[model samples]
Target: MDSTRTNKLLELLQTIGLQELNSSKLLSLVDEALIHVSAGRSKNFERLEFLGDAVLRLAATEFIDQQYPNLPVGRCSSLRAQLVSDRWLAQLGEQLQLESFLVLGPKALGDAAAQATLQADATEALIGAIYSGSGNNLEPIHHWLTPHWQQTTADVLARPHLFNGKTMLQEWSQAEGLGLPNYTTTEQSSRHGDPERFKSRVEVGSRLSANGFGRSRKEAEQNAATEAVQRLQDVGSEINSESPNNTPH
Candidate 1:
């Protein structure tokens, strides 16, 4: 690692109150974190984010399972999912000012909009780096991650249906052998009655599950998917329950 780069990273850690970190060890760890993207190699943090995401989920699940032995599997899974979400991870990254350390190409620079994704990815990479540096000492890593992890878990469990409707709907569908639920969409950019908005419908099976109006396709799709998940969960509960005849042997 370049001395200058190492010093910058040390300053970042110090800002985050990791003042206790030995200079030499912290430098080594920063070097390890950079390995996720390789030195001057990648434009996106996808690969590192992927590994970090798995690590976060697994670490979170292990923590919750050990701490709340009586919690149902569904809630445990929900908590894990919440902790590992882009939103929560991004928030944690922002708290650490993780974006300042990102390695991005010139074309990607000046994109403040990219901060959310970059922060989320950097957060994961940091977690992966910590885990790797700890010699798999999940105990220390768990402690480091616990504050944000618990906050996310608590928020999710407090309103389980809110953050997890999509996941629950997908799981329910798969468990019932419904095959993968497919989404079909139709959009109209201008409507006689609603001139300012674009209207879209998302359908599953023969049912028009959601209606959304947005100015763009991406926004419309997000809105439609959100509503579609809600609709599925609303109708899927009783239908998904196993009857004596259909119960597994």
Candidate 2:
């Protein structure tokens, strides 16, 4: 990489609080990943991406464990999935405006829309690069990602009932012999990037279980399912409380 490019990358890293970096391994990988084409040199971030995928998962798990020692395995798994998901990574990459420094080839440069798998891949590769540079250490990764991780964990835990609502609701329905839940979505706004772009209603049996709004159809439906799951949990709790199974066996 050129001196100007190296300096720019360093500046970006510093902006995100990676102040005392020990390794340049991460930066090299970042450069490789951002450059869409490297004809002669095979220094792409693909390998780093593979390594980062595992490292990110491990570091996220460690973060969750330290923050929530009493949290169950199932719950931990759910939280970890969200933390390491492509959507989450892409969101972070976009927030940092990583694409502004990307060195894309002619074809890849044409479609400059900053969404989807590319940014996510880059983010993971970045983690891998950091890991490789830091001599397989996780301290720097944790330090850089701690704030984002905490916020993400908080947002997810706050909506604890919303975790995998669709799957949970489906299982609950099947167990209760109520068949599959039906969902209907309607577009509230046709404009681009509207938060309340779609509204969804979920039905169990002949009754409307719940309704929710989201940026996309899937999100709206999931939100509705979360509502249903919350209702179900409340009802179940109440039922158990009232059941008279003789006094404290």
Candidate 3:
């Protein structure tokens, strides 16, 4: 690690509200954080995103379980989905002005198409960084992520009958006794110089039902499953609602 670069990054940290970080720990933290953010096709964010996701779900689950004891399981899952989505996280990052603080490769910075996506990725990467740097300290991250979660939760709770794509997809498959929807990752690219992309397909009943793309495979799979559920449910609802006597007996 370069001392000068490390110093520069430490200085940058203060601008992002980490005024209490010490140089030595910041060195290790920033090094790990950068490596994690820039890993794979910069795929490191995926793991951090995964960790943060788990944390977010657990936190949301605990909150709902304790507070909304009368809420159904589906509603709890819907609330969790709204709170932990990438779109909401990206909004939180923007509120924190996170884009200005990102340390990206020159190429990544130069691309217009990738700029929007970097915010979401960087946010997840930062969450990952926080977990790594702070020893999985939920307090700081919760402080950071809670407002975003709150707004999203409020929006979702207003319409408790609605289901998120992930939840809907799972329920649709279960209703059919489809033996659980399966995900197959078709492509994952994280080359150092290339933009990262993940592609996946969701299958049900030996049928390739949907395809999706994302900066991470998890995101892609979620999208694919969501699409599959939308299609499946629409079809199922139509079939179920048909008049029984009008149908072939």
The most accurate candidate by lDDT is 2
Flag regions of model 2 displaced more than 4 Å.
Answer: 22-26, 37-41, 112-114, 161-163, 171-176, 180-249
**Model 3 per-residue lDDT tens digits across residues 67-139:** 5666667556656666666666666667767655556666666765565466666666666666567766666
Candidate lDDT scores, in order, read: 0.59, 0.73, 0.59
Model 1 bad stretches (over 4 Å) = 1-4, 14-18, 23-25, 31-51, 110-113, 167-182, 185-249
Which of the two candidates, 2 or 3, achieves a greater lDDT against the reference? 2
Please list the residue runs of candidate 3 whose C-alpha ends up more than 4 Å from where it truly belongs after superposition.
1-87, 103-107, 111-144, 155-164, 188-196, 206-208, 236-249
Model 1 local distance difference test score: 0.59
At residue 56, candidate 2 shows an lDDT of 95
Q: CA lDDT of 237 in candidate 1?
A: 48
lDDT tens digits by residue: candidate 2, 15-35: 778747724666776676565
Which of the predicted structures, 2 or 3, would earn the higher TM-score when compared with the native?
A: 2
Instruction: Quote each prediction's TM-score.
Output: 0.63, 0.70, 0.53
| Displacement of the residue 214 alpha carbon in candidate 3, Å | 1.7
Instruction: Name the 10 consecutive residues with the lowest summed lDDT in model 2.
Output: 239-248
Candidate 3, RMSD to the unseen true structure = 9.4
